[model samples]
Target: MNRLKLISALCLLGATSAQAAPSSSGPIGPNIGYGDASNANTIYDPLANPANNALNAADTEGYRVGLGINAQTRIEIQDLEGASDYYDNQIDPLLNDVANAAQLETNLETFIANYDQGNISTISGVTVPLLIKTDSMAGGLSLDYTRQVGAAGIIIKGTGNVTPAADGTNLTINRGSAALGVTYKQLDEFALGYGFKAVTSGNSALTIGVTARYLTLLSNQNNVDLKQFIDDNATGSANFSDYVDGMDTGSSDSNLTADIGINWMADNYMIGLTGMNLTEPTFKVNNMTSTQTKYDYFSSLVPSDYKMKAQYRVSAQVYSENREWTLAGSYDLAESNDLNNNDTQWWSVGASYATNSAWYIPDVRFGLRGNLIGTEKTYTNVGLTLGFLNLDVATTTTDFSGVEDKQKDAGIMASAGVEFDF
Candidate 1:
């Protein structure tokens, strides 16, 4: 009965807080729509889409900008029945053997307090990307902008087994961020980019990132928060009174991480190897308390540090006189400590056809993508280009077991923009 109540509460929370937000790929190509943009559609250039491929083609003298919106809703249900029985032995010896109504209630409350914390986060924003090729430069320059607003709600109802036993715990948080980035390319083979991100909420912090494609390197840095620290230590019933002795002695840490990749391109095929987050940077939050009538409470939570070691991608394209078809696949290395991490792989096949019917539409393209994450999922997208304007839409779904227990995530994402020729 306790399990049923917990599941029901989680479902309610997930449904209420689910919202729509702008996806990462609001500009440029559809290849970056759901997966990595590097593998989307490559015509001659190894890194960019075929529409903007520059290896064997002349640099186009023009600029393009786009705007898009994306929304997602998901439901997750986990069964603790199959989890390890260590909890029964250490926390409650009689938990597993008890069958009485009162014992059942107590055990359920204890389990929920220890592990059942429901989380909901929503991110929405507007993104803009601008690309321009000048007469003097060999390649082009691109500028990116994103302004997003986010909110998160966390609920951890206290259990019947803890010292400060409480019926329910609630926290509502709001956050906002703005980011700007610029990239410069030389002869379409080498590129350099840097970005800045500013976040404001309970605390304010700044993050900076840099990317170098020729050398296959990318790095980023940012600060930490105290609320996150409290959440991390909530599971352990240790006395935090000592940790939060000084409220003015706030704790903060910085993180620095990098990625490396190698690329090889042929006439019709391309392959690449990449490693993300090679630097294992840890962010720690500390809580300190003082000894006097005066009050001070400081707390901190730190995230586990790890690196992504394996990531590879392969892509091939077949071109006709005026049309082309592309196929690609990729695999990502998984994190060990994060339960949400999964060893996921993806495959995509898409085709673009040319048209000259100026009265209706100029071009049409279609694509199909298959993903194997925690479960098997499939996505389909259709795009149209007419003169200076481009538009696209996509949908995805997942299948699992049970009716009420089954899960599905489906949404419509669209982007529209114009290109200017100098």
Candidate 2:
């Protein structure tokens, strides 16, 4: 790819786009609408907390099925669009005309120095094509994809020097010193879960549940070289599209993981605890090499082995006597990271109302959620259910001027699905 094309690709890496707070690698649930799921009692619960499958089935008479799709993205930087404009309109052009080396250095330094280094921007989506739940069991399939890009190590201003070729047609920088580190991964899961009443005392029952899933994984870890393409004397010549295709390291692997949970069900209240990724399955992603150039490209660091860390969470709920009104809350007992290694720990609380007697009146749900670790932004959630269809959306309270003077939030999510009971 030509120098300008290469630069353009790099600039789009952190473009002003959607960011998300990924709570689990499961199907979309009521939590996506109400910002909490401890006692929501939905068919898709088994995908998130195995115990929920049987626990929720207890509230129904027969079999249940749910299908859902969810997508979300997050950008925490205050002025990300501005940063892209600075790079595309100013720094990139100066790269080719090395005669203005002094000006190029100044612009590059300013771009790096002003960039947001505090938060890790993320994009994630999950689709649950089908899920089946019975009185004592639940099983389903889910596909999850996540991408995380942190701009921290990409630019080390004082550690390296930028120098242009004597003829001012080419530029050089310390190899491996300036590059964007990006990680993308996807998981396809075939999951099965079972639950049973373990103990009964007074008006409450303690139900235990366990789930195991066969996982198919694909991942890519890329380090984009900023200086390689600018070298006019470089040997390789490829268009921007071809170069991007080559960036995929093409790594795939598989493993088995499991989750366990327990729920104490009572007449008017419920409490639950869930533990996910109990086996701590680990995977590998090929560390992409720098763009092929005549110069040595061995200085780029190899990515570390990535593993799925275990996470624990707790939830509680209270309901009205008629079972029409519900209040729920959920919190993470400890912080964890998603597949892309972004920190995550969330706390959510919300309420919902449904008139089970009427199909014409839509079920209403509202809630709030915030991350305890990364970004730490809070969001307001709203959802509606009409007959067998469901729709949910959530957005952060804070907004920033994005590209073209448009306003955007730090995080947002939308989900839609259908469910039926037989």
Candidate 3:
């Protein structure tokens, strides 16, 4: 089947539907939404870089609680124009013609010759229902989800050349073991972290922190089979409810993991290093048989283990002489797979201006970020702080060369929260 063509159509539809909701934002930090975590303030810093908790305790005494959500979807197509043309002129004309063997063979060949393997798509997000931090520690509850559809697969043709009935009501070829599908994963975790002030020398200090997390895993591997899906739709058995009941879901036992970080804070400068998922916790995907089997024609594609890989990062911040303006940067030391199993390593920079003594005045923040490995798209970030409330947004530039209004690289993220101090 025309896999890239199918993905192209879905991408176009997603762009149109996203207008009603907040779309992709790089990483979920209202204070540094553009991707820099090194110079985060006390409240948000602990979650961004656990070691910041110690520095924060020494600098100020306060506590805060907030909620945030970050989600994004991206589809990259090398020749969207060509793909659209194929989809319009060839694929759509015979989308449900399983009875036509000759036409199906021709279309399959066209898909292979012109596809060229430059298509990829991923949907991923993080939701923080409650995040809190005190002078000495930090803790939170968060949920994460990812959906990845593989564009690579092989088609198995029948052994004998079969001819369809003239009446056009019978099948021409047997639906063989040809397979294609997507992977879905979700995680919910509760985390508690603390940092210790190790040494104080002159106007500089050193601190180290560690966070422990308890995680629950859920997933559906090989959730879709193109052949089965199409047949269901044609036979009028593929409604939304049926689709939901078709999945063979899986869950894993609870697991524990940890993150470690260190920071060096000076009079007007700071730098930090962090390693996340230090233990690389592993989960075995288990089948939780579905209740309804109406559309459960496909079997589980493959059973595999999901492992959280360790990721390392470093950051630095420079403050203005008067302490009103701040500039900061952060970079990932090595590549790691995101929630969607896509490789990613990011480098981010940001600048902010604030008045130390004003609660009514609004603080301004701006930033730029780019992925060093996967997606490799650059984004612009902007944020505002008024009184106890913080708001932020980030997005990538649009591409006009492809289909009109199609968000080929369309991505955006928005977060808002309020805080209080004692």
lDDT by residue (tens digit), candidate 2, 216-279: 6666655555565454324356443443464333667889888888888777887888888888
Evaluate candidate 1 by giving its C-alpha RMSD to the native, one decimal. 13.9
Candidate 3, which segments miss by more than 4 Å at Cα?
1-26, 31-34, 57-85, 96-104, 112-167, 170-180, 237-241, 244-250, 286-303, 321-324, 399-407
Summarize candidate 1's per-residue lDDT along 116-204 as a digit string, tens digits.
43333222233344444343443233443333222222333321232212223322111111000111000111233332222223322
Number of clashes recorded per candidate: 15, 7, 2
Per-residue lDDT, model 2, residue 18, is 30
- Residue 261 of candidate 3: its Cα lDDT? 83
Best by TM-score: 2
Over 155-231, each residue of candidate 3 has an lDDT whose tens digit, in order, gives 22222232222224422222322323334455566666667667879867787887777777665544333345445
lDDT score at residue 149, model 2, on the 0-100 scale = 24
The segments of candidate 1 whose C-alpha lies over 4 angstroms from its true place after superposition are 1-29, 32-125, 133-135, 147-269, 272-312, 321-325, 333-347, 353-422
Better of 2 and 3 by lDDT: 2
Against the unseen true structure, what C-alpha lDDT does each candidate score?
Answer: 0.32, 0.57, 0.52
**TM-score per model over all chains:** 0.46, 0.80, 0.74
